[model samples]
Target chain A: MLTAFFRWMRLVLPRGDAILLAIALIASFELIGALVLLLNSKVSPVDLQLARTFFLALTAFVYGIYRVNEFHPLAKPDYRRWLETTPWTWRNPLPGGPVLLVPQDVVVLALLMGLNRDFSFQTLYIPVAFLSFYLANLMAINWLLGEWQLAYSTGFGLGLGGLVFRRPDYLLLIDLACYLLTRIAVQRSFRNFPWDDSHQPCAPIEASKLKGDSANHRLGWPYDSLTPAKLRIGFRLHDAICFAVLLGWWHLTLLWGADERVRFLIIALPLIAYVGIPLLRVFPYFYMHRSPIDVWGRIANSWWVIPKFDCVWIAPLSALMLNFLLLGWASWYEWTVRFRYFEVTLPTDWRYAVSISLAPVGTTAVSLALFLIGPKLEHWRLTGQHRIVFQRSQEFTEL
Target chain B: MIQLQQVTQHYGVRPVLRRIDLTIETGELVAIIGPNGMGKSTLLAVMAGILSPQHGKVIIDGMERKSTVEHELAIRRRTVFLPDKPWLPKNRTGREFLMGVGRLYDIPDDGLIDHVERLLNVFELEKEGDWPIRSYSAGQQKKIALSSALVTRAPIMLLDEPFSGGLDPSGILALKHILKHQVQQERATIVMSTPVPELLEELANRIVVMRQGEVIAYDTPTGLRSLSQCTGPLDEVIARLVHPRTMENLEHYFQERPKC
Candidate 1:
């Protein structure tokens, strides 16, 4: 059974390195949490319990959202086709028959259990809540797939059950029972899989959907209709606004909290979520578009050309300015509020300060590096040749 | 004239073109014929300035691609390249795509609309012209791509397997007519690559035969026939030149007749 489980895992999560990376990141986060707990010996047991619960709930929420999006009926038709053909029943007598758990479910359950200080009934509710949310999402998807009668009956029953119970424990039990029943129904549905014939065609294109000439007209300074310079400015403005909002939220939530460690996390989490997460997501697109030759070509002949400068220069400069603004605001808030108002002394460790300072510096350095090396990298990726050869040959021919 | 001097390219150690030296004159319809993975597409990409060669230079008339900003722009404005699998802007109508391409070349607004309409009609895409490219079938997408290239009205065109993308017989005939018209009326230079030699036999002024990243023969259709000593169709002559052992191998396999 264990071997079969491993085989199923291997089949589903084929990218071994990705799994390893996720594991490494999770372990590192746990290590940091442990260190914070150890350093802040003044933390009350109740506060610690509350923090753990918050972390678990956050994890479950993120996992639920991912499940909802990942299992959308219309997404990944090829994968769905494969799943339909594969034999997944307990009666099939295959090696991995009756495999129910997916990687996300296993990872979330393990994390919740591992992080809980007391292994009690409350810990059991975490996985149950997660499964209930995930299964409920799948039920909604079934309705979208045209199982209207079954969907309405199931939804009505669940709603009535929730109202009648009125107790938290009973509601959780009802959620679990409903989830199990739906899981069995989904398995049976997979056996038949009637939704294959209801494939949706591509969306029609209309003139109204296109960007109009009026939209392309200049709005104001740094807001042209179609230029890459304007795009860079707009992206920078967006980042600035997002960072300011996150900063405001952080202040509102954690300003009165007495625990220094929690306060530190309050500041750090927003920075990681807003600036770091967005950078991670957008960097690939940025790198692909950062070709110097293409940028120069567009700037030279484009309708809305920036005079006396290339648009390629804008991205790196904008990135640097945004990072400076974020780091400056963070430092100001740290000094003015945390140190002065809360009487929280700056860390004597120097390593903490150095690491925090290095985050923005490192980001700026990477942006500059991308600006300098991006064209060559793009050329290499596209044509599979060292750019130096083209550079030298062009020079030789010119001479 | 378009000149490629010792143009060499590779995809990660797998050489696609090796020291390719060729020149194409103005108003010439040149067809590059080869088997799969013989660098027909790579040669066209090099000419189009879409892929920079590692060792050689591509020169259009007097201006060299990648020389300077102005020089590159000048070369690009005069040349329009249609890749083997052209990626159309998904959300835009076919008419809008053609209009966008026309605008990029600085065509007059009055001329642009007329040219777009004519191209759409020529390719039998008039009914679907107003529809978005995302909803187009494979053949329709190919027609739209061809239409966009035609709308540019550039002096030089580099097309890679323009006919292989689900084009029906009538669409192929329409494309052939358009190619001939461009060469005759506008003195446009066209360099197209195809695996099928039959398409090029009647259309091409000169045929360039490639094998394993090297150009083996560059001649007229009759010249190729005489050189290969095959008085049959150009397809047979190409098979003789590129895959001489193919017939012998097939004969041996059939004679042996191994049981399945």
Candidate 2:
């Protein structure tokens, strides 16, 4: 686990100190926000402040030491020259090397030390921290319901470092196993592919060499030789799987939580129409440029938006269709069961139509105004030019 | 004139173009001839002002690096680069594409239609000029791209592998005529990079040979032959320089084979 964290930390930080500092600041601010939200609800004020200070200090300290130590893959063994050379790594002769410690592990240990008032004897009770965290996770699982339990195990555990607390003592061992799995899968899938040893640790290339040599590789800057079509298949597939899983979980959770069929339909309606259609790629991502030419044709035919007014008929038509579907289903249920019909009393007004038309227009005008003024405001504030530097070396080094 | 003084371009540490100096005079027809991956495209890109070099100055006329907007605009306006792979605006017809280029060059409305029509006729593309370029064959697409470059009367033309797809006799004849006419009328610097020695040898006023990202020789076809020490033909000399291994076998086969 420590090794993975070490690799991840190295991966996230870029080559230059300035970029490294900026990234650390960004992560630290996000961490601070999460901590503040966690503390604000029911936690004691003193405890909240202490926790906030501790997190900030820990983050700063870890990042600072890492920077000071120059714990970077790009800065050793003639780093400048290595960028030009084919990246490779030597085999680790010792299979069972010393287990690495992650930033989280160290933080936990530090917290334990503080709690026990054993600052001088920090390493003595590292095992206690691991055991307590594991016990907390195991106890937390019993309190979880069906979907929550699955969410805890997969999304929370696999994605957000919850799994680390479960088996903190054997964290390194667990990470090694996962690493082995990933390696085996990669090797089996790729076989003798060019990037077989791509993940192996290597040194950085010189800036001079990078500039000189990478000009003719076709993927050079100013002109990206990449075809957008090549990425579509994988991107679509991944998005579909993620959306399907999330929706399935939500539906299952709602089935357990809700009792009324209409309530369930109402909840599911927003998910399917507003989110699911777009998520599933059935509807296009953006409002504009999604079959722009086709939309223009529709506009010309008066099947879409009205000129100047820019009021789209599709939204209102779709809303009416949805309302009719719901109302019709309800009326059928009422007629069959001999229940009361409330449709005659319900109001249908033009105010809703007017508001709907105004909403997107108002929002779009505001957005356009913001977009035009944003750079000017930033320039005024900073007294610096609004320059977007797409430095490729930063990405390569960060990775 | 575009000047490259000691310009070198490297790709991931390997030098593609070594330190070199060259001046492309106005109306000069310079053809870059070299083996594949020999920085011919890089040279074209640099000359077109599409790329920035590592350790050299690329000045167009008197415009140095990031000097003035007017200079850059002038350079861009006067230059029309037909990339090796043509960028056909999908769903846009050939006429529209030509019109777009014409607009960019600020061509007069009265002359635009006539200019486009004439070039289309010359390239044998007038009948299908209204059709989307995506429907055209590779040869036809190349002709359209070449015609677009020609229509603008851009003083500097950088064509990377222009004669890639096969051109019919009439098309080839017409293209040669147009190029010759450009030199006579507009003083356009038609710099093209082609691996095919025969096509370039006939039209190229000067040929520049490159190897391992450096210019090996730059001279006229006859001058290049003299430098290469070839007696028979210019193509044979180029073959000897570019692909020496096949030359002996080719010579033997030609000598041994009965007169056809």
Candidate 3:
């Protein structure tokens, strides 16, 4: 039945889109369920089962169709043409290349199977170990030459490895190996993933061609190739804005007499990335995107993966995580070490726009004024050559 | 001046253009007309420095014949090459798109808006100019593309199938008028490739005929029509020359095969 369902799916969605939609649906379900639990306090066993069945059913349908679409082979000439000039840059690798399924990353599915249970480090340890082991292995590979593909391979391999294992011991060894490897491996590939330089912004003509390829053979998703640098910058910007707003809220609380320790935690994390990371930069990198442990949920099937389940999730998640970590560190420092050093206040009315922030009624009117006048004051500054990269949609349209 | 000396281009094992020698002087209005798939677009791309020749050299304004990355970007900036279908920034309004382009080319402020407004009015797009190009019809999109190319006012212009889909009679006339004006005022050289021969009869100073990746003749439209001994009109002359009888004979063999 699953195979039959997959066969039909191949006809409708391309592999890249399929993977994207799968991540989206899974994340939506998780988020919706979480929202329900938050609002209702009691989500039934039947509700949980229904959600799991829906997720598995959707995955089966998507994966099956993607596999069927993968059958018809592309011409050698065309494939070679794609490889040499398909514009699969380090920034945004086209999803048309050969897809290597790292079976280890499938272990994350095990976590999904056990999602409703209490936190069992022992039960969860196998998948974590698998994730860490492969992540470590790739870190070692990355240290040798900062090979991004291998680094990703390690993460995917470990994650998938945990799922196939029935016993924790088998998972433990693989996880241990990956962990040790990550600890010993040099972390030179860690940096910002430049979103501007990504395939999103760089409109290379050939990129559009690869977008039409079959599912498994299609190039990896865009966020799959985001560099560490771009991710860091995105995170810092988002977190800084969120932290400022949080502070503003805390300050307002002071007027209302609810000022507390959480305010201090917000101000202390600046030293962590600037001082600690550099000092311990060589230490085993254990941050999200590279972290082996699961947070509240599996990132693969969480709200975190929504924007980029295809490619959107990575940018936002990376931004959110980086900010969260940095701000968390700052908050830690303020609470433990510098209680009397600063006074932060919350705004009388919240000005920051969180994912759920409400905007002022006249924001659009204000924006239009800025837009009209902004070009008048600005001289044509050459921000290098404005490059246009075509999306996959363009090739079909061009024809 | 754009010069192509013994240029060759291939699509895999099949050669699309043979050793072709051609030159367009500065400010010359050169039109390349041919049957389909005869490397007209390829030639334009090669001349625009978009495609490097498989063999031989393309010298632009006395430069040594080599295509460098900088030279390509420089050529693209200085010369506007409009593909058959123009690339429109769908999210941007026609006015915004033109303004952004004008700014990119270092056109002065205040003047940019006025210049774009004038062009928009002339193209009968005054009402739609303020709206995003996504709302534009096919004809409007073409006009926008042509308007973009015109606004750039680059020294060299390469247009491929510029008249394919769009253009009212008045719009066509306006475009011709603009092209002529650009040549006279800016001393801009224009190379346009179109399937339609009659369209260029009044405008083109020189029409180069291409067939099967080679330029069979390069002369004025009148001269080519007079010289060719082909049976039909200009399109037929192009068709016969591009697909010689030898290849068409293969069609008979395919047709004879039994149906499955």
Candidate 1: list runs displaced more than 4 Å: A1-399, B246-260
Name the top DockQ candidate.
1
Regarding TM-score, does 1 or 2 come out ahead? 1
By lDDT: ranked, best first: 1, 3, 2
Query: Root-mean-square deviation of each candidate, in angstroms?
Result: 19.4, 24.7, 24.8
The TM-score-based order of candidates, best leading, equals 1, 3, 2
CAPRI-style docking class of model 2 based on DockQ: incorrect
- Candidate 2, residues A1-399, lDDT tens digits: the string is 987765655533435675567457646755766677686786565554455444544544454334313422222223323522534332321111111233554554455345433333222324333433332332222212112333233322222222233333344344334334333332232222222112322212122112222211222121221111111111223322443443334333333334445443533354335323222332221211122124444444443532211212233334344433433333332222233763342222332233233322332232222222121211111111111122344221110
- What DockQ does candidate 2 score? 0.02
TM-score winner: 1
Two-way DockQ contest, 1 vs 2, winner: 1
lDDT at A260 for candidate 3? 32
Which portions of model 3 show Cα errors greater than 4 Å? A1-390, A394-399, B64-66, B229-260
Quote the lDDT for B141 in model 3: 80
Residue B224, candidate 1: Cα error in Å is 1.9
Cand. 3 TM to true fold? 0.41
